[model samples]
Target: MGQDYKEIAIKLFKQGKFDLAKISFNIAFNETPSDELLAFIELCDMAKDSPSDALTLFEIYFDPANDDSAQSINEIIDIMQSSVQQSTMEIESQNAITYADFKNLLNQNDFRTLFESILFSTRIIITHKDELFELVNFLVDHGFLDIGLKYLEGSAKMFMGDERMELMLEKIRGKDENSLK
Candidate 1:
């Protein structure tokens, strides 16, 4: 019975149905208490709340402690990647929401609040050079110079020697300088 619930929870979790997964994990925990099940419950809660937080929790807490850490980490990574991919696809499906529309959104809402909400909630794994470039450009253009620079610097290893990435770094630096002036 407990194993049955655990299996259901895992399936739901992989499907990005964290709410249902959490309930299933809870039921499983009640039936057969274990640290592993408790961790899964906590992971489901965090993933439901925010994928970024879930990834952080898994990296900082679960990965180090678990005996079967590799499998656990892989599962969490899969969930985060899937969620990010789905979000990316949705944004793409909307035709990338024209720059003017996005600017309007930023103007109507507080940009800092909105940007922070996205930055904290989503674990953006840039799968393409274009995605990184576009994201850095958007951040810098929207006055998130520091964040843009941080992202550019962090991605430097992956994008090293890429002309577009170099141009983006220069653009971010140029913006940073102008802002300081």
Candidate 2:
């Protein structure tokens, strides 16, 4: 059974299905722990952690007309990567902008920054309404209710009259209420 899981994970990984591969690898590890499974798990984690992966997920969830957010996120990632590589030593200087500063910029209503932050921090694949609801649930579960609320509100406004937005708001409200209980 462990070998079956490992084989399935390897096939999924080769097919670029990192999330599914990670799950299979985790199951295999539980049955029979192995360094190879651990390595695959690490690789999946890295793939999922990439900003590009998040951008792809954003594209999958949002409408084509809303590509502006994804574009802005791509630009931010490019700028961040270049700046970091060019001034590795100057990162500690005031000239360098840390990730937290970037989040602050988003909170300041810098439109591009806000969208970029959403794409970077939330690996949300909002394909269906249920998926969007799940993303909000995840954000709340992870103690990012405030940030998640902001993004949900922003998305609701961006795609005005979206029924899913209302549903998501209701679900989030329920989660908030439950948490306070």
Candidate 3:
């Protein structure tokens, strides 16, 4: 019976019906209590809240020994990426804040509070390198040195060995040091 539920969950998950998949996975987990099913449950929850983080969890759960796992992983990636694209489009349409308005907000004296509010409330997905650079610069210029540095450092992992990223890291570090004086 647990195996039946697990099978159903996997099918639903592959179909990108994550909410239904989660319910099925939860049922399977209650019946079988297996680590794999638990992981899948967690993955489904992460997928609901954060698809990007779900991809990381999916990679961790991937079985390199299984020949079919690679295909499954790719399929999951495609599904999650499409989901993220849809979400990004929705959020952009809803917010529709221009770069100039964003910068204006950042330049305000209460920008720290506003910035933190926006950062926590929004799922900013930078699709372009220039936008990423510009965002980091804005953060730095507005005294959000720590956040800007963290952003640049996180980006460095995705864009390894990119000279621009390296330069940004160095620039942020210099600013950080000078600010400490």
For model 3, the local distance difference test gives 0.72
1-181, model 2: which lDDT tens digit per residue?
9999988987787676888988999999999996556655755664544525533543342456665754544554564456446555555443444444544564677544454566554433233334445556556666567767886875564445667677667877887888899
**What is the per-residue lDDT of model 1 for residues 46-89, given as tens digits with 9 covering 90 to 100?**
57446566646555534456777656756665665686678778
Clashes of each: 0, 0, 0
Ten-residue stretch with the least lDDT total in model 3 = 94-103
Could you say which candidate leads in TM-score? 3
Query: What do the candidate models score in CA lDDT, each in turn?
Result: 0.72, 0.61, 0.72
Number of residue pairs clashing in candidate 2, backbone atoms closer than 3 angstroms, sequence gap of 3 or more or interchain: 0
Clashes of 1: 0
Candidate with the larger lDDT of 2 and 3 = 3
* Pairs with backbone N, CA or C atoms under 3 Å apart (clashes), candidate 3: none
